[model samples]
Target: MKSLTQGAHHIGLTVADLEKSAAFFTELLGWNEVARNEQYPAVFVSDGTVMLTLWAVKQEPSVAFDRKSNIGLHHVAIRVPEDSALDQIHQKLLAHGVEVEFAPEPLNGGPMRHMMCYEPSGIRLEFIWPGE
Candidate 1:
């Protein structure tokens, strides 16, 4: 096996609305698609260093809310550039008719902002700044 120091790379998740979901990440997070394989039903997006991939899965929106059976996947938190960016994200989410997971707040539990939503298949997603 490769050494543990090799480090981790990307995280992949299957989503219902591939284009819309990809837009949600790229447009909101400032990522761009660099690679794709339709046969795999997935595409990779990156910002020079970090890479994110979303797999296309055909499913209904209700899937995002139910997890009692498998608890399949919880939530994915993508770190944004700053603490202030979340406010802008929240507004955008509203414009798009998405709900907030809990109101946005500071990482230290103070008052700030963050973007939180469930994808078309009910998988959890988040956008926030990394801890101080």
Candidate 2:
């Protein structure tokens, strides 16, 4: 037997603020708004290779995602082009006032490095740099 499915088409994330989330991708991450659905109140963003659908929460007082207890997405790991890019982006995140869980450091002991942070809408994101 063989695997029948292809890779991910797109990832959907529920956000507290639609506009803020969209801005995070466009302004901060340099992604483009590819499409929008008014009825669903969602924004589709792409960085040329990957697409993510940001959905607005329909209700107020929504609960935040807890990686320890919740059974959903832990974090979205985005790959950077080079090792130094990780530090560059980390500085950008700080200047933009994004909440960083930690600064860029070794992934385990050697090669790859990574950092953790939360976007404006509280979505956990991990940026990684695979060493050459």
In the order shown, the candidates' Cα RMSDs to the true structure are 3.7, 1.1
The C-alpha local distance difference test score for the whole of candidate 2 amounts to 0.92
RMSD of 2: 1.1
Q: Which ranges of candidate 1 are over 4 A from the true structure?
A: 1-7, 58-69, 111-115
Q: What's the count of clashing pairs in each model shown? A: 2, 0
**C-alpha RMSD in Å of predicted model 1 compared with the true structure:** 3.7
The lDDT for every candidate, in the order shown, is: 0.70, 0.92
Candidate 2's C-alpha runs over 4 A off are none
Model 1 lDDT per residue over 1-132, tens place: 877675438878877777877887677657789888888788788866667788887555434445566655557676777776777777777777776675577655654346577655457777777644
lDDT tens string, model 2, 49-117? 789999999988899999999998999988888999888889999999999999999987859999999
Q: How accurate is candidate 1 locally (lDDT)?
A: 0.70
Candidate 2 Cα deviation (angstroms), residue 48: 1.3
lDDT of 1 at 132: 43
